[model samples]
Target: MHELSICQSIVDSILEELSALDPKPKRLISARIVVGEFRQIVPDFMKEAYKAVTKGTDVEGSELEVKTAPIQGKCGDCGWAGDLPMGDFKCQSCGSSGLKLDGGMSLYLDNLEIEK
Candidate 1:
């Protein structure tokens, strides 16, 4: 699944960042990730992928916390700004399809807890 590749990328980044530290962490404790609704990433699948990928790594047994952000957009025609359902870019107030997405469709590591 794509989640496997995504987890691998996350692990690679974590390792690279850890190596750059002055002393480097002995082990990773947990990780916090922010995912937008538009990203469509299944949290359970991601957790499973992470567990499988991290199996023999320093981050093994580490907790993964995922936070989801709502999809936000602004209507270009009526200046309506608010949350919207995923994939529905239409403005609720003005019934306009001309909308500008402001948030969602984002995935990023928020924080890492490590032990020295």
Candidate 2:
């Protein structure tokens, strides 16, 4: 699935960053990632893909810590700001349909733990 490609991208980015290190890292220990709910990335599947791609590589066996951020919404009618349920943007207050999605649509690497 797309997770494979995503994992590949993660590996490429990790490698790129590692290459820039002054005393290059000997291995990666962990990777902290943030995947928004809107992205619909399955943590288990992504982890499997990462393990598969990292097999026999320097990052192999490294842990992946995924943090989830809720989808936030802002009501255009009542100016209410809060978390919103996935797939729908109904405002909690005033029951207004004019709700604008705020965040929770990102997938990025937060931090990486490396060994020297």
Give lDDT per model, in order.
0.86, 0.85
Q: Per-prediction TM-score, please?
A: 0.89, 0.90
> Candidate 1: where is the Cα deviation over 4 Å?
none
Task: List candidate 2 stretches off by more than 4 Å.
Answer: none
lDDT of 1 by residue, 9-107 (tens): 888887778788878788889988888888788999999988888899877899888889888989889899999987678998998999888669788
Q: After superposition, how far is residue 51 of candidate 1 from its true place, in Å?
A: 0.6
The true-structure Cα RMSD of candidate 2 reads 1.4
Best by TM-score: 2
What lDDT score goes with residue 12 in model 2?
81
Q: Count the backbone clashes (under 3 Å) in each candidate.
A: 0, 0
Against the true structure, candidate 1 reaches a TM-score of 0.89
Worst 10 residues of 2 by lDDT: 99-108
The superposed Cα distance between candidate 2 and the true structure at residue 87, in angstroms, equals: 2.0
